[model samples]
Target: MKELINKYYQNHSLIYKVLLFLITTAVIVYFFPKGGKFKYNLQKGKPWQYENLYAPFDFSIQKSPEELNAEKEEIEKSKQLFFLVKEEVKAEVIESYNKKVDFILKDSLALKMNKARLKNFGEKFINNVYKVGFLNKADNSKIQSNQLITLRLGNEASDILSDNLFTTDELVSSIQQYFTNSSYESLENNFTSLFFEILEPNVFYDEELTNRALEEELKNRSFTKGFVAENERIISKGDMVDASKYEILDSLKKEYDTQLWSKSSYNWIVVGYTILVALVLVMLFLFLKKYRLEIFHNNTKLTFILFNIVLFVFLVTIVQKYFVGYLYVVPIIILPIVLKAFFDARLGLFTHVLTVLLLGFIVPNSFEFVFLQIIAGMVTILTVSELHRRANLFVSILKITLIYTVAYLAFSIIQNGSEQKIQWVYFGMFALNGVLSFLSLFLILIYEKSFGLVSDVSLLELSDTNSTLLRELNEKAPGTFQHSMQVANLAEASANEIGANAMLVRAGALYHDIGKMLNPMYFTENQTTSVSPHHDLSPTDSAKIIRDHVIKGIEMAKKNGLPDRLIDFIRTHHGTNTIYYFYKMQSELTPDQVNIEDFKYPGPIPFSKETAILMMCDSCEAASKSLKTPTALLIDELVEKVINTQMSQGQFMNSDITFKEIQTIKKVIKKKLHNIYHLRIEYPE
Candidate 1:
């Protein structure tokens, strides 16, 4: 099995790559939530887009969240709280105060007051205790009516009292009034103070009993306010949907969504989702294959693009299910920004549109979601297409976020015809999304490094001559370093003319000859003295030394953390072409048995327009330096001869550069080299 897998991978064709991509897409699409599709797209105050809807079954009209909450509040407010009244409370109180009353009567005997008056005072206090009925301290304040109270005397007996019911406050008032109207008013003051201190309520609020009563009352309240009979038109066509009408339609939508699974086979839902996802993904594949074949052929690039799409869909599904109305908080625009950084604007927009469409199944308003996401994606592409600088990204993100806010506001006004109904939290979310989108810049750097991809920011950093590698190259081999700069200029100009990646070609040219730094004195470009080191060396030895630079440079670059995209230029610059000077010298010196294999540099050849342009520029710029006379004709001839020689050697055979682009590059090189070496007339001294 491993052998078969290895054999298949050895031939890595386009069909296999596409099959892998399709399998990945299928796996990713299968993980998406296929709960159910929305049956209707109705909105409040908007005309019904579908046909006149009627109740298919006699399902009860479910109440809105607001209606259900209001009903709960009403039930809570009107429900009576139950309290357990103890009828023996009065007897217990009288028993507790009997000794105190006897002490007060003994004191009256000492004062020589009337025994009848003292007895009257004790009776009045006892009557007040029974009148108030030992009100509960905790719940007596909440009793607002003089209703009947059920007194639990003991386990065996119970009594019902009709007129003794009083709240704690009323009980205290009754005690004070009884003392004030006592027959012995002056002595009753001391009695009232002492009785009030000992007063304790036997009746207590019953939490369990209250909760049981509340549960019973709530059970009677209906969650469904009314029922819609079969064949009843919920809302006719062209009707302006008011709040009440919107509630009925929404209830119908909820019911319809619930009933969708029972009416339709679940397998059909899976098939429908599969077809929709496939169609959108297939369109994306075709677009990339036709216009951006480079990315299409690369598995890493394709994986990054498709992974972003699937991840966004998964996140939207979760947010829609849990976060509900906060879907706008998701940074949908960041996907385009990140893709645009690695790929191009067209692919970014395409991926974003496909993702939003797949997520439309879960978002509440399909039209609103698609509209906002598509507009944000387009704005991201337009404002940040050329994202080479940090400030450009900041400005672009702000604009895209503002566009989301304004567009959402406009949609809100169009739907409800008023700004009062718009949720301001969504606007805050859009602004926050804009701020968070700045993280894409960092993510782009990460993707470039991880995937062996090159981005504009990395290219710009590579182009700087002051970078550690470039500065080291300049100090180690000044001549080779100058040659690299001239090649960079020529390659950049030619790339611009041919509509290729000018920045990429320029960065490649700057680092193409970094391998020479390992043994700078062996190459002619860095030879500062008149003495020639090759005079003592054999031609075969010289060729080997020259060819080893490519291998050594790759090791140094890998050690120093240079990306593979830049290392490709070092590998392909010399290609499989032979070192002609040493080979010819060796043939002339030993013509009897000349070996051609020792003179060639091992290479994969230039496979891209940027690398091929670097090869041509490297050869032309080095050859132009050998001209003895400084004239336009000599420079022009030098450029043409070098380009024609490289072309005939088939150095660009595998590259995508056309013959017409080659000619255009030749013209650009001639003009640039001429302008550099043009003669200046001698001035009179």
Candidate 2:
């Protein structure tokens, strides 16, 4: 299984690329919402751009959420509540009242007649109370109107009661009237006092029945305000889309969108989507191939770039399905920021544009969406060019957010001719997007570690001399470390002149000679005294020791988890060139035949301008130190000799460095070296 996996990854052939393309296409298509997109883009309050729009079929104009909510509020405010009369509750109250009357009769012997008389009075009092009806405090508050409400006693019988039916004043008055007709008028006050304690609401609000009725009524309320018949001209071109016109146009758009998926064939939609995605991907690949061929050839880099694009596009699509209004919160500018951090600005902008174009299909108002994203992407590329500094990212995100808001506001005004139509939440989302874009700083580090990729931020960290490896290099081989620093300066200058990656070359030059730390004294730079270690070894052995540093450097770099890009500097600095000193010594001793392979440094020559420039810098710097009484002329001679020798040996043939760039590099080296080795004259006093 391991071998199969290895074989699968070992060859990046046409089959592999085809498989990648197919899988990418499948993943993207799976995330897409199941619907056909409306062809014409329209917005509320905007002037119509296309010709006259007509309804293709009879469709209802659906109410907006705001309108539906308003209708619901009205229903809640005016809807009547039902109350069910519990006859058993009246019976329970009357039994309790009779028991209370018995207690009262026991206490008031002077005024009471027989128990039957008191019980009859209590029953009469309870009957009068039930006639008025009872409602809870909450239900009583809901009836604002003074009109009567109906109370249902049974399926066939009911009564209408005033809104003030259950007031305390009415309860006492009814009790007084019941006793006033009796002989126990004196007992009326005592009985009325007893009735207050036992009184409870028999008319309970039937919430379930009331809610059921309300729902039925709400269902009768039409969700559609009106209808447009088939072949009706909705709006003409150049017509201002007012609220009513916008509503009709919006209704037509929604109906057309729905019918596009349901009534029309979806097979063609799938085909169209597939073709569009393929074309965009193909364009991205071709752009990389023509301009950034190195990234194109590198499968990891290409996958990283494509993965970011697809991931963001998928996220945008999902957000469109749910939070369509806050689409600006997706932070599409993160694509350009991440790409520009890892790669160049040109590739970043191109990838961003293609990603935006794909998203345009899924979003409403394609022109505005595409316009804002493209402009924000441009701002990201131009402002966030250097992501090493935290301040740069902050400033860049602020500018990107400002551009998004301004562009969106401008589009909103063009549509509505007023700022009131703008959605403030979208502006807040743009600000949140700026804050969220800061996450890419950490994401940059994650991608660097995951994909074996490097960014300027990582390069800046690696350039610190206090790092463990660099400090170790200083402790073991201070002279060699100093030489590496000098080479780094030269290489960075030359790279900048030639438009190569200056940061990468600078980092590479610093760690290029780390292998020499393994045996510092053997190298001449770290030798403290006149006594040389090479004296004890033969010329072939000494050359072998020198050549092994490159191999050792690579091994140590791997052990320490250094990236391959930096290791390339260690591998190619010597460019298979001979170690001339030891080789000449061996030739003088033998004078016969010596194998060239033993004398040459193991190398797969420099393949980039940075590495090639480092090679020249390393050779010229090291050789220039050997010149006694160095003059400007001598430094110039040395620079030309070293670079010209490397060029003649075809060390730079594999690199993309042009002859003109090489000339520029040579001139830079001469000037820098002359400044370092300028002739000084002693003055006599």
Candidate 3:
């Protein structure tokens, strides 16, 4: 069941693919116009409905012939009404003048009989008869009946009477006359004059009742004004070109009928979109195949890639949607970063290219932009290609900045024909982006460490010269330090021969025997005073201490933050092989209770080429010390015997070591051992 699950994840199983397909389908479906409304609306030219319906009204200047004619007719009608009313008022005024003259004369005579003065009686009688107030004025006696009745009334009353009678009558009569006696043409002329007179008081000919009659006349002609009002509201065809002016309610209805219901080009667009999505999924599947073996044990690659792809696509889509006009170049910068974090530089370059191609399809006017992106991406990939240190990552960012700057300027010049004036600005922005990339690299490193990726750069950092644990080993167990140095040299050389990571092997060698610092005297290498600590101890006790070093090394390593790879080399270098001479001597004297297997070193054996080489080197170094004459034959025999012993004991069973690699290792070790134990020349005295 576990193997099946492993294989499923390894092959990027249908479950994950289906999940991705469903998610992508959901996203595309959600954004796709429902019921073909958008397409139907588009086909029916109803794009205006999509515009904001609540937009502010735009002010504009406009004029129309109907508007002008309606306005003129309204004004003319007002004028005609004003003139007819004026005529009727004038006739009434003439009759009232004659009657008023006769009444005034009779009242004057009656006033004289009542003992009132002639002038006072005449004024009072006129005031009573006309039912009007008299104004203060000189020559009051002139108010009597005369040939023309030259009354000495105040100008207020006279003006009021003249305006109320003549102007009001003229206005009413003119309107009525326009409707009654005049031909249509004449009536139109009168109506226009009357309308102007009433509606526009300044344009009216009658000055007598201009203030009072004009307001009333305009009120009566409101129906004509309404026609002019319609003309005022009639929107011109040019005005309808505005999207807001389009009736949204009507447009929405049409869109539902035409665009939503219509099946047209949008179906093809959806088909193309789905195919693109499938292509992305396929590409992701292919890219993940490289980790098939690794993912069998760890699904980190799958998890990381899925996370980045989803995150990147979402971010790029957002940038494309909201920031429509501006170029969103973050994908160009982020693609290399994400790939470098999840995989390596080679894969990062591939991802960069893919991102550029994908984004080009999304962004408007993306040709030159995509070209710039490609240049930047390539530079970014090159910058981080062989990064084995954090400092190298930073330096790579600087290089990336320089490359991007040059590329951006060159592209800008080619595309827009812009001068070099803003090149420094571009350089500054490029440098800023490089800084961000460096920060992103740091973040990835932190995340990788958190997840225990154990990149080569981290390994190098852990193996630095000033490593505190190594320094402690040098101080506490000088003999073990010397031993580790020798082992490091031997293991590094052997690893190099076998095309393994020589530095890693060397570093692992340096820290391999650190457990000896706990009880340094028990080991022969650290016993400088000629007193062997194990001489008084039993073989079993001595073997126990010897075996304990492997276990002890692991504890000390954990305390010092040493990685698992180093600890593995420490533990497995002596792979459950017996302390042969001691165990054999004990076997001669002891019973079956003291089993030889109990004296053996506990190990799962070397699982890697480097560890296996270290194991062979450890045994070969110890055995070589016993040889008086270190010749090629002795060194060759010792190397072969140690390797063959370990191999026969099944110590190399689980390792990737082959016979060919073992032969190479033997040759290298023989040469090194021979050099170390070479015979010194006698003095020539």
- Among the numbered candidates, top TM-score falls to 2
**Root-mean-square deviation per candidate:** 6.5, 5.7, 20.6
Question: Residue-wise lDDT of candidate 3 within 480-551, one digit each (tens)?
Answer: 888888888898899889876676678788888889999988888887898898889888888889889999
Query: Stretches of candidate 2 above 4 Å error?
Result: 1-11, 44-46, 102-129, 141-152, 156-162, 168-192, 321-328, 385-395, 411-417, 431-435, 466-477, 490-503, 515-556, 571-685
- Candidate 2 per-residue lDDT, tens place, 483-595, comes to 99998988899888987888988999999999999999999989889999999999999999999999999998888888878998999999989999998998899878777
Model 1 regions more than 4 Å off:
1-7, 10-30, 43-45, 51-55, 73-80, 84-91, 107-173, 180-182, 202-220, 225-227, 234-245, 384-397, 431-468, 486-506, 515-561, 568-685
Local error of candidate 3 at residue 424 (angstroms): 17
Pick by lDDT: which candidate is best?
2
Per-residue lDDT for 396 in model 2? 84
lDDT, candidate 3, residue 607? Answer: 72
- True lDDT of residue 163, candidate 3: 25
Q: In candidate 1, which residue pairs clash?
A: none
**Residue 418, model 2: Cα distance from true site in angstroms:** 3.3
Model 3 ranges with Cα > 4 A deviation: 1-437, 496-499, 591-597, 647-664, 679-685
Instruction: For model 2, name the residue pairs that clash.
Output: none
Error of 3 at 548 (Å): 1.7
In model 2, state the lDDT of residue 49.
86
